[model samples]
Target: MLLALPPLYLKYFEDGYLLVPGFWTIFFFISALTLIVFVVVLTVQQKNNEMYAQAFLGATTFKLLACLIFVLIFIKKGRPEKLFFVADFMYLYFLNTVFEIYGLLRTLRNQNSK
Candidate 1:
């Protein structure tokens, strides 16, 4: 829903195809990271419960660095509505981060109950 809404707005009300493609790219990038994090955390949790936290932290650092690199690359590409791009990027980043944290919390809760 988050990924699709922007494009609809752009198509009906905007002039460019900027936000749609960029949002899709970022959405997939973040989705991949989320999957990797879940897999790594689940593996470590199963293999050595003591390492689960560390695994989560490592994955988070990786995601943060990846996002930074992505932003840097976008900035280096050109000066096409730089502020809007950054703002949209940050908004999506925050939305995804919150979603991830919510998922993590739910996972942790389930684990604790078990």
Candidate 2:
């Protein structure tokens, strides 16, 4: 998915500039963040599967807060590409979130079946 984003961005958003340095960096960052969240949730599920919802919520909150901070700092740095940055960021966030939820549900289902 991350690998495919660049073409989509180039095709759809000609002016889109994800994160400061480039799209690849931001993509990797978001991908890494998603992995961290997924791992943390998996750990929590192993310890107490019933806490999946809470764990997901907490991870989401943390991600949102981190994104907010990033946005604030980016804005402060005088990056005038708000629309491009925001659109790409939100797209990445949404995609990663859905992927996370799907993986969690699959894990839950597997555990329940056992």
Candidate 3:
């Protein structure tokens, strides 16, 4: 998610890499959102704990920045092709979300079993 920001937003929107393979971008978006949500729920569960709370807020801020940057780029692009890429990006976001959810669940189960 955060690791892939430059290519997804900067390259795709700013440098016109919109025509490149979008599988990575899609995976990134989904992964980013999933982690964002996971961090959020974890934060809520550990509401009174400062360490986890800080991490969650940090992640929320990053995700918010990414969303803002995305919207800003879209406003500047303003084209049908751009819209197409955005859809592809969003599709990947959800796919990554599911994968992250499964991964986190597996991690929890493993820790419990151990």
TM-score per candidate: 0.78, 0.78, 0.43
With candidate 1 superimposed using the best TM-score fit, by how many Å does residue 31's alpha carbon deviate from the native?
A: 2.6
Candidate with top lDDT is 2
lDDT of 3: 0.56
**1-114: candidate 3 lDDT, tens digit per residue:** 443665557565796545344446435554666666676756554465435446555655666577658656654665435655666565555455556556556645674596
lDDT over C-alpha atoms for residue 25 of model 2: 51
- Give the local distance difference test score of model 2: 0.76
Candidate 3: clashing residue pairs, number: 3
Question: What's the CA error at residue 17 for candidate 1, in Å?
Answer: 7.6
Candidate 3 residue 32 C-alpha distance from true site, Å:
7.6
Mind sharing the TM-score for model 3?
0.43
Quick one: ranking by lDDT, best first? 2, 1, 3
Clashing pairs in 2: none
Clashes within 3 Å, all models in order: 0, 0, 3
Tens digit per residue, CA lDDT, model 1, 1-114: 565577667767997556634666766776777677777777887798778789888988998998899778766775547666766677777777777777777877898899
